[model samples]
Target: MFVNFRRIRKCQCVQLITTCLVLSLMMVCWEQLDNSVVSHVKSYSYRYLVNRYTFINKSFTIPREEAQSFSNFLYLLDHPNKCKGQDVLLLLFVKTSPENTERRKAIRSTWGNETYIRNTLGVTVKVVFVLGAPMTKPEQLLWNKRAGLGLQGELLREDLLNGDLIQQDFVDSFHNLTLKLIMQFHWAHIRCPHADFIMTADDDIFVHMPNLVHYLQDMARKGVMDFWIGHVHRGAPPIRSKDSKYYVPFEMYQWSSYPDYTAGAGYVVSRDVADKIYQATLTLNASIYIDDVFMGICANAMGVSPQEHVYFSGEGKAPYHLCIYDQMMTSHGHIEDIYHLWKVATHPQVKQRTSGLAGRLYCTAVKLALLCQPYHFNTYPCKAAFL
Candidate 1:
């Protein structure tokens, strides 16, 4: 019946120490926890409970006259006739910086090569490098009246040699990416309206042209419409941190969850969807600077949901293996080794190694190992191993 007073006092001290330690740990991790877990909870709640994005449309819509201001940039370099007189299967737009000439060269030699696509794949794919005016340093802007004149000359020469550059007059900065997005859709609506499909990809991304062509051919045969496929981002919350490059202030977005969107790394839209997106661009507020998020807004307004493609990679590089190469539609973040990847990925041996019962079994095991990781590789989702 007697209480152990000393033991109780010791227990109280231990509890106090434990509480302090837990508080210290939480303080250290609170920012990360809020950024990830708390944000996701808020996003999902808004996405499901609210269930209506029409408000976004009503709020973001502007007069087409006002909207045209964003897309009215003059074309410094263009190939208006690039897709003319051809039964174009896919009009591929590579979102590129003005300085990434080497990356463009690498792409032309590998996946984006129109000659290889025409003769080898027997599909008419037009590759166009889309860019805005080169951005000069703020300090240099004062002295140089025409800040990008030298770069313009080089771009003109490059466009003449390659006949593939589509350069607009707006300064090519990350904040102006939505303008580039508008440029692609608007240009496509005018110049390449007959193309069966339109694909937009980053400069550093590797597209398996053969696989992509075959897939598009199959889809074309199926008479696919409203087809927009890539690595989809669903119910993603905006980053509220001002210090982050991807920060979205409450005044700008105000939404808890963004409508579903494909990764801006690479994505494909059928001609019909492209037209719909173009129409959306004519009226929607293009003030949202994140190109992919803006794309989501546009698609949401059009009631076009993004479809996830297993072979289409997100921001991460796909695992370097024949199994991955066999079906890869796109692999992002390939800067230096694109040529090497192209050579090995498209090797005839890949088909040989990944065919038949034995090959299938081998590939299944390989994919399970590479894709079904304990942590996300951000290449292919774990479910892709089965596919």
Candidate 2:
């Protein structure tokens, strides 16, 4: 009986010791978690608060008419082999206006040519021009009625002759450009969510299809996920001047500086991020006139910061030189300059002469000279290296 009693005591002792050790380990883990929280708070910037406050104060009310805007909004409008029976590497969505036929044509001929991008670069690509009709107007009421311009069940019957239009019924004006972006993402989520990456560019920007493809291919090899990359703007202050088009009053946002965002001129999002951003669009206050700022808001909700690439010029023209052209991705403000830039960028002499390391050295020297000269460098962010 004494031996049995001693055995019981030993068992109880072991149990007590195990319990004490587990409790100590848990306390240690909790201390580490508390320290991490302190570190996070110490590094907090106003940009972090901007995201939280904006999300917390989200005014995500969709009017009955607007709620109906998502259905049959963008049915296969000229998507070349849109990941059906194949894997699509990239899907490019270009935001275009209703009357910009010339811009669309120029884009189709130049970098927007899906066939050219695929054939030359050997990757599956699809391009779609996103469009929406202006708000229902009085004199144009009959035309709007015929075109099925709203949630009145006529949205699917609209006729677009060329078949490249991803038309929705929302008003396509500057005030509603953010809606345009929202509609684009919604369509992609429903139509092409399997795309490896989705890119959005303004109709005015010039996309260097070859360079972009190669860069993305390299990323694919590295197995990147949750990606967003562009010319990132960090710690940009809001335009409080009421006269400015980008004005944001204290009522709209209380933050001193806006969150980091890529310029609306052009940007890219990975496939998973597209769905997340689309859902974010529904939950955030998107009344901000600047589309990119709104995009930053959505991206922040998903904890994604855009990776910066210096070659992706933000609201500026990339410097015009063979070396710059060789590594450039997209240059903003390029409507009339699109075709000329394409020709210059893809010149035969460029291929024959500047083929390797020696060419890079010569171009780097020339770029240094331009930078040191003072006149051109001040106006342009000239650099020869590909980022």
Candidate 3:
């Protein structure tokens, strides 16, 4: 009787264990099924919404372009050896007004100055400013006065260190900005196509040349080409309100959202795509107010896409943290902040730092807190959001 009772208890224990194992397997299967259903719903909903949005805003127009000629715009006065030598690493172009001589001076003294870059970083850099022809004698006088040259300044300043300016024959006005942009690409396409990389920035920007050089080297080593990189804006809608400075009329561009484009303030491109974009400019609409968006349209027509980088601040300055500033490549709208920014960025104490994991973490948290700060911060007016 005792043996039979023991056998019955063993059988009951085995049945209980088997039941628990089956129950656990069933729960796992149920959870997976639930998750799969949820994922499917989300995927379908996203696709549907995106399709609907695009369908609603679909727009197109045939540009009434005549036999466009960029050759008529060549009013170059001083053509420097844009690249130091045959093996030029970067051809940096700064877009400036004919009268923005102070900004140009500040740039040459700071980031745009290539002497320090070549001497210290061992990278060949060429700095050139792109401008359009001045309308009147006073405008010409202003340019020559600020640039410190005579009436034959263009001819005489050929050998001058700071004479690396390219002034095309187009009327120098805000409306002619697109012509100015295309002219740069055309100059690059014909004059300096063999350059490894090219960059375009505004006169008011503060560029950390050392950081930019390192970034370019990495891209070159990785064999990156057809490259267009900066602070990319995706699906940015046109400013329809007439009161705004960026207002775009429907007659100009019917599309609601402009194609993805890097900010015009500063961007980098490889040799492979420079010519392609120059060709694109010949056919794409050239009447857009914003030069960056116009370039974006040209790029889109050629099926080339813009790559986004956090370091390139578009239309804004980056928040001033030591680590953040050290890593940033470009910041915008620094009209008067250029000198101050250069001082802080190149400070010796900020350069030599020994930080462990904890230090990095602490700085990152602090930056995050600052990044999400409410309105009325430096990030505003400067557009200093972390890219």
**Which numbered prediction scores highest in lDDT against the true structure?**
1
Q: Candidate 1 on 1-387: residue-level lDDT in tens?
A: 999999999999999999999999998899688678989999999898986788888999999899999999899888889988999999999999987889999999999999998999888999999999988777667625544677778888888899999988998889999999999999999999999999999999999998999999999999999999999998999999888899999999998999999999999999999999999999999988999999999999998999999999999999999999999999999989999999999999999989999998999999999998888666899888888
Choose 1 or 3, whichever is better by lDDT: 1
* Candidates by TM-score, descending order: 1, 3, 2
Tell me the whole-model lDDT of each prediction, alpha carbons only.
Answer: 0.92, 0.72, 0.72
On TM-score, the candidate that comes out on top is 1
lDDT of 2 by residue, 1-387 (tens): 437888899999999999999999999998767755653453255546533544433444445455445333543333433556757788888898766668888998999887788788899888888877744667666657443435323323322434456766665677777877887787788678788899999899988888899988888788788899888887676765577687778787666666678888888888888988887766566767678987887787677778877677787776778867777788888888889998889787765566688987787776666533545421235443432
Query: What CA root-mean-square deviation does each model show from the true structure?
Result: 3.7, 20.2, 16.5
After superposing candidate 2 on the true structure, give the runs of residues whose Cα lies further than 4 Å from its correct spot: 1-45, 48-83, 135-161, 369-387
TM-score of each: 0.93, 0.74, 0.75
| Residue-by-residue lDDT tens digits, candidate 3, 1-387 | 437888899999999999999999999998767655664554455434453333222232233253165435556565645553567888888898766767888988888778888898898888888887655555556555544334235433532646688877776677777888887887887778788888999888889887899989999999996799988876666666677777779788654467778889899998887877887766555767688987887777666889877778787677777766656788888878788888888776555541566656665666667666666333322223333
| Alpha carbon deviation, residue 249, candidate 1 (Å) | 0.7
Give every collision pair in model 3. 316-382, 317-382
Give the number of colliding residue pairs in candidate 3: 2
How many clashes does each candidate structure show, in the order listed? 0, 0, 2
TM-score of 3: 0.75
